[model samples]
Target: MAKEAKKIKKVVLAYSGGLDTSVMIHWLKANYEDCEVIAVTGNVGQEAELVGLEEKALNTGASKLYIEDLQEEFVEDFIFPTLKAGAKYEKDYLLGTSFARPVIGKRLVEIALAEGADAICHGCTGKGNDQVRFELAIKAFAPNMTIIAPWRTWEIKSREDAIAYAEKYEIPLKITRETNYSKDGNLWHLSHEGLDLESPTNEPKYDQILEMGVSPENAPDVATEITLSFEKGIPVALNGEKMASVALVKALNKIGGANGIGIIDIVENRLVGMKSRGVYETPGGTILYFAHQALETLCLDKETQHYKELIGIKFAELVYNGLWFTPLRAALSAFVDETQKTVTGEVKLKLYKGNLTKVSLSSPYSLYSEEFASFDEDDVYDQKDAEGFIQLFGLPITVQALMAQKGEA
Candidate 1:
């Protein structure tokens, strides 16, 4: 820690213009002694959070402020690939925080190199997973640059202490100890952690916590039906209207949020090896995943689909563990892309009270054959053929049963 700090004259920080990051700008200058802070905020569809950010950064003593609109790139490059791979952490999590970290880190490293900064700093905490995600990405892109994680070295202990420091340094912040719930948001999803969520048994105060979207309990009773189109597993249109990748997500977020489509709560195992509770609102992502899976069921054959299901689990872990820039993740993504070649279709879904019910689906590559599957009459299928096929398919089970019978006798 001491060794890296000695030479860090300037740092490009992944700043959010939020409580922690705003505090970090002043804290870095104070602790590093005459060091310049270059603040970089990636606009990955954080919408309102970006308003007036430059003023905040400058007020907090940032030498410069860079706000890049990464909505399209983030959706196309990062979000789509992960969505195509069906990478959901645990059974419920959408890997929102998992994937957003690297995208943000990529820009941070880019700014660091452009500014000729000696190090990259971040506001991620010591205990949480973002530290690993951001730092590992920085190492992947700019290996030689020093990486500084302020949470690990800062003297301020808790949220309360940080608030005190913010007040003392005259850093503008809207958060206090009682109201602070650590949150991360992007185009994909919004996640809430800390505070009452730290306990698995405690029920969340949804009124206080539901910032991104409403819960199903509060949603309107009427069900909303919509159709979504996909091309090679990438969502392309909503309700027959073609949309840009970023626009599609934004549209679904509103429609899904209105119908109370996406809200998840889980006590998940973190990358750093502790169980943590998070409540996530992934309105757009849930719709995309649901629609894409329906398309896959229509287009993908049984063998390829089953194999990809197994791959999805591994994909989820790789994303969650911050291995996005690694060769293994790239290799897995290549396989996922291959499977998605024929996964083009439109899927109809009914969204109501947190439920996304599959109503109908169609695809150009659909393997479903109504004629062959019919019970009444079809030249394409013969009942006699099933005798041979079933016999062969069940051979192993028959043999095992015969062995058991002989032993019993």
Candidate 2:
């Protein structure tokens, strides 16, 4: 007689309660045959979506459902650190989804270990960067555990197929024929893709799909001013009132969203080496990034600031590519933390129709000295000293030019 097939005892799935993940739950159960599926949902910032997720997961064939409230950790640990580094992928992306992955992935791994599951599963497609990010993070945290990427293994290829599969299995899905955009939402941002957005030539209609932020066309004409206070590069207060991390982020999201503060459309380089067009709405993140950057400008020195800019570029790349668990990222974070020591202050910003304009910023550690920087006669800094300073500064360039002249002669 043939040996019996090895059965998967249990699997921890990173469930989003979306169409893809909803379909994945049944698919995993059917394929594995007798496997107990445990669904884990991370609450980064999808406030409304979290309402019925536990019940939905249980209804969709998950033996157990774990919804971890990770909003505070997401903001304090992941979001703030990236903000402090001034990390922006390719100059446009605030990496809202990028930073959220590691935190979620860590939780998934933790739950998988606790449950003693044979494998960890995710609904991310093989074509996307998220699959790479999720799998890499899983490997980093649990090297010995097996990873089950259903999208790569499954016959379901498109959204239509996913919808069909969900329908066949009687799985409940929020998306319908009228609204079919693939969206990823967290406390930091909400991203929209698919349909008209799939074509870069087609302009995104502001009225149709924007959920997190107000459309610029519909935004209030009056500019709204907000004051953000930071201590050692972390946002601690808003408008002179100290609030909790979660509360502050939610407040900023509300204020910035009202003013249409953060909406970015770009074709970004995915980790899978493809250019994907995405429309991101990151109201609170935009406010935080600008305010933190302005505060750093007031506190950090020229050399440190310049170097930090370079670090920001690399840091953004690392986070976007999903290499959050790597040593290079840790080293970069350490450098970023050092640069942020004096990055304490308050920044006032004017929010008007998708623009966050820094009005003024003040820091106790501010390197800007009015007496020295003033154009008018000041007691500090001698004008004559500039002549000697300029001569020394230009010495190498002068020598190089003189050498070239001598050779020409």
Candidate 3:
């Protein structure tokens, strides 16, 4: 059952300065008996979206706006852990928006608690995964706090309803009827959904909707090569030059974006039990994941590496389902960290026309031995030993066949 939003004196809203949120500030006041609304917008690398947000929030009716700079923490704390775990939702999505929700939700709770706010509000629609992501994180931190999800209880039904409410209230919005596509952007990636993208049969209008980079068809002919360095599984440098986490992602975004890399269109299963289509441009994150995996290849042993693949799939599901702060996720992260102790290394990659080609990879803790793997004569390993090993390995199969041959009923 949805929680009741009653007796709420003050509410803190997760404001994005987008269409829904911009209209929400005014709607909350009108519907919630004119409750005091304080808006909080986390600066998780929504570059242009941050512009004049304070003025917009204040103008619309928010008492005050808090735009917290969470880019560095978003990368170091959330992104690196997922990257190290090799978590990719459904083998494609890099969990850009998925991992970002918890960080922002945590900050929302902080601001709400500090301001003595009675309830927290959000503009997420009822059918979206973000509503689950935001509310779960909020409940984890502030279990007693009231969560006011207007979409579930309000008269507004769809994007059209939202725009009508905004128009009725004389509220300003950046999106129009023609360009009203649902978008989520942060440092790691930019995602586009809704409109023509909702139809699986229709090809994405990449030429018109792409914001982070150009389409693969229009990518530059020449390949772009870059060297990336990692320490304890976190990206620390690019092209042999050390950089801060945020700077490194930004730099790689520029390079990878130019090369038309890291764009994926997927029909993902939402936690709401619906399949939604989206196109994600994760240039920097794609490069980082590729490089990290290359380093792991040289560092991790077969057993550990293969087992970690299962862990990665689970990690992806957890993040996609918005279980970021749970104990299982933490335990998994700890195990990934242990594996990453030897994940310190450098990887050189060539990016061209949306393709990532590994040029070279090296690590100090590399387990690869050229001598044992070589076809030429080597004293390190004896080929004759394989006979006994294969015999033991095939014992179960041999016994099953012998039983059948002897007709042992």
Q: What is the C-alpha RMSD of each candidate to the true structure, in Å?
A: 1.3, 1.8, 1.9
Cα deviation of 182, candidate 2, in Å = 1.1
Q: How accurate is candidate 1 locally (lDDT)?
A: 0.88
lDDT for each residue of candidate 1 in 245-293, tens digit (9 for 90 to 100): 9999999999888777788889999988989998899999999998898
Best of the candidates, lDDT: 3
TM-score of each: 0.97, 0.96, 0.97
Worst 10 residues of 1 by lDDT: 1-10
Q: Pairing residues by index, what is the TM-score of model 1?
A: 0.97
Residue pairs with colliding backbones in model 3 are: none
lDDT of each: 0.88, 0.90, 0.93
Candidate scoring better on TM-score of 1 and 2: 1
Question: Which is superior by lDDT, 2 or 3?
Answer: 3
Ranking by TM-score: 3, 1, 2
For residues 1-409, what per-residue lDDT tens digits would candidate 3 score against the true structure?
A: 2133357769999999998899889988877774899999999999999999999999999999999999999999999999999999899999999999999999999999999999999999889999999999999999998898889888889999999988988899999989999999999999999999989999999999988888888999999889999999998888889999999999999888888889999999999998999999999999999999989999999999999999999999999999999999999999999999999989999999999999988888999999989999999999999999999999999999999989965
The residue ranges of model 2 lying beyond 4 angstroms of the native Cα positions read 1-5
